[model samples]
Target: MSLRQTYRLWAPMYDVFLKPATRSARAKNLAQLGRLDGLNLAVIGIGSGLDLDWLRLHARPAQCIGLDITRAMLNKAQIRRRDCPFPLHLIEGDAMQTPLASGQFDYVVLHLILAVVPNPAAVLAEASRLLRPGGQILIFDKFLHPQQKAPLRRFISPLLGLLATRTDVEFEPLLAAHSELTCVRDEPLLARGWFRGITLQKHPINQHPINHHKD
Candidate 1:
């Protein structure tokens, strides 16, 4: 089955199975983004809207949008609207080709998306276009580190992709190639350091240099 079809079947089980299973990691990931109380935010690949509450804590519901490629996922996300304090827009769209205007959002939340999408670099590029200068994009997913070589995992990645997910994607190269965005935070979250919470920001050229200090 294609990624869309797999997610269609996975949508119902997502809130029940995946949500509880990854709750701690999810919370930890969102915490890395800090407080986003008054920003225009967009959640790329917002499956089932499980992270809506976190977005609500950082942004007004009206200022946030949940974009998903599959109709089934968006339909399930509708159930979260009742629980949201403000109105949350559920949009059916591709993360790689979002219809949102360029440089529109203050923040873009990319949770559990990079490993699932076919082209993560494209998604990041589109996100770069959607974010205003200094706007940050929060990423929470499993990615191979720069120095870590996952030979065994890479060999079995084809089997894993049968479930519409990729496990051996390395974030180092992608981020390194994107000159406009800079990594602000990269921390482990779950699975003995397999999954991580990483944040990247689109900053203006020749602006303040990124300080790699513990400040």
Candidate 2:
């Protein structure tokens, strides 16, 4: 089944299963935003608007945009919109390539999304694209460390990926490809370091140092 269809099927029970496990991690990651008084934020792959629940408890932002591929998931998110202090806009779209303009957001949240997509690098690139210089991307997901031997995870990743999310993705390579993005914080959140909370900042235009190689 396609990822959209799979998630559409899971949408009805998504919160029941995910909320308990993710609540504390979500709050901790969102806390990294520091103050949300007037920032423009995008929550990519915002399934069921669980993060919105957390935002409702805090200072309001100027606006928050949420994009997800599954219509059912977006529908559930709509119910959470009623209580948001900030303007919350939900769009049915792909995370890999969104319609939103580049450099328009002050913050981008990628909660439980990187490993779920077919091309995580593309999603990360898109998140980076959406951020203004000095904007930050907050990521919370499970990732495998480079050269770490996890045979079972690698073996089942394909099947699990088809069902919901991939289990074999590595975070380093994704971040490495985007020279403009710099990792400011990375810490283990759950599952004995399998899941991580990472924060990345976009460097100002022409400010990231370039490498020089002698030939």
Candidate 3:
């Protein structure tokens, strides 16, 4: 089954299984935004709009856009949008390559998405592309440390990836590919460090000092 089909079936019970386990971590990850007044934010792979309530409580962004591939998931998010005070727009679209304009957002959230997508690097690159320079990306998902031997996880990653999420993804290599993004904070959140909360900031333009020489 395609990932979208898998998630379409999973959407009905997604919150039932995920909400309890991820509630605290989600709040903690969103907290990193630290009062987002007048900032434009995008939540890529915003499954079931679980983050909306937290955003409503913690931030008053100028606008927040959520994109997801599954219509069933977007339907759930639509229901949750009614209570959100900030402007919330939900789009049924792919995370790897969104239709949104480039460098228009102040922040991007990628909770529980990296491991779920087929090309995590592409999604990360897309998120980076969507952000304005100096904007930050907040990620909360599971990752494996380089050279860590987890035979079972590596073995089952292929099968699990088809149905849900990948277990063998390494964060370092993905981050390394995007030189413009700098890791600011990374900490373990759940499952004995299997799941992590990471924050990345896109480097601003013209960082080098300009030399002023009079001829």
Give the per-residue lDDT of model 3 (tens digit) for 128-184. 999988888999999999999999999999999999999999999999999999898
Model 2: residues with Cα > 4 Å off, grouped in runs? 205-215
lDDT of 1 by residue, 111-193 (tens): 98988888989998998899888778888889987678788888887777767688888999889778989897888888888
TM-score of each: 0.89, 0.94, 0.94
Off by over 4 Å in 3: 205-215
As a whole number from 0 to 100, the lDDT of residue 17 in candidate 1 is 85
Q: Rank by lDDT, descending?
A: 2, 3, 1
- CA RMSD per model (angstroms): 3.5, 6.4, 6.2
Model 1 score (lDDT): 0.80
Please report how far candidate 2 places residue 133 from its true position, in Å.
0.2
- Local distance difference test scores for all models: 0.80, 0.91, 0.90
Candidate 2, residue 27: how far the Cα is off, in Å: 0.8
- Point out where model 1 deviates above 4 Å: 57-62, 205-215
Displacement of residue 165 (Cα, Å) in model 2 is 0.5
Evaluate model 2: give its TM-score: 0.94
Considering lDDT, which of the candidate structures 1 and 2 is the better prediction for this target?
2
